[model samples]
Target: MFSIVVISNATMVPDEAAIIQQLFEDGLEVFHLRKPEADEQAVRLLIEAIPAVYHNRIAMHGFFHLMEEYKIHRWHFREEHRQETTKEEMMRLKNKGYTLSTSVHDLPTVQRLTSLFSYVFFSPVFDSISKHHYKGVAADDFYLEAEQKPVPVYALGGVDARNIRSAMAMNFDGAALLGTIWKEPANAVENFKLCKQNVQTY
Candidate 1:
């Protein structure tokens, strides 16, 4: 089965931690805690709201220092942060058992990725649902054989129940959901289950 990852809404949402905990309960294995506008204290409060048992399933996008207190071992770096992080720091994280990941927007970058990353998000596979006018490449142009990719790639933008199968058919290992899950926060769990069922039944 193709993996399905849920990315936290970029801004804080009401009952966000509770919603996330429900996602984990419903079999969400990977949750990216990506709140770009939030400060360390805000992020810390959010993390503190979630039960400790589910902490390990989360991948911290910023404020990585919280990982120490929460026992989170997964870390995801955006393109800029990935470029700024030195190899030595990454190695140290690796030695400490952190599972690292990063994002890319083009095929060349995907081909150039080092084995240091466990996986990477290749985004905007479809026009972004969350971000206005952030276009995705043509599906035909996006196709890259497994041999051409050095790291496992998960489709990141505009992914929802409707197009997850297409993403997998295009050779993506998985699809990550942001908009589809949070478009209507009240329906988050239902939307996720629908997306998961869509892939599983197809």
Candidate 2:
């Protein structure tokens, strides 16, 4: 198992591209650019900020129109965005060689969606570090269902270096962190190192 982190859901961080570039340098396998409220130009500027070489590892969360113009090879759909898409639309995206992923908050949803995505973000495996009110579900709830799914189920929410190994041991194919990474963007590389170090423990 490995690890991933969703970028902050808010506006761009200072020296954002540099920080992201460093994450890539630190061996980040996938970079999720989730800008929930960014306008087209804002998204454009952010993508432009990163090097072209890293585009393939980027998974987009919004501003899909940019996909046509960028070389980004992966996409992420929240449940709301997912409701608007059809199987045919998904197949079309796959035909283009693009990969798809989405977020689900529960075990049943992950089971139902097992065949639809390259992977799914099964969230709040622990209480959210970014959203204090969002307490986590039992990790066993994730392990039990994920063990049966062919598709990868990434443990999202509250994962950090401390518990990443436990998450992998619980049957998550990988871990996805938000607050742990965003909490200190300047230290993101060292932070990612911490998670990977835990992963290596397994």
Residue-wise C-alpha lDDT for candidate 1, range 75-119, written one tens digit per residue: 998999999989999999889999999999888888988888988
* Top candidate (TM-score): 1
TM-score against truth, every candidate: 0.96, 0.93
> All candidates: CA RMSD in angstroms?
1.2, 1.8
Which residue pairs come into collision in candidate 1? none
Please give the CA lDDT of all the candidate structures: 0.90, 0.80
User: Which pairs clash (backbone N, Cα, C closer than 3 Å) in model 2?
Assistant: none
Q: lDDT per residue, candidate 2, 25-89, as tens digits?
A: 88888889987777889889988989999888889988888887888989899988887899889
TM-score for candidate 1, residues paired by index? 0.96
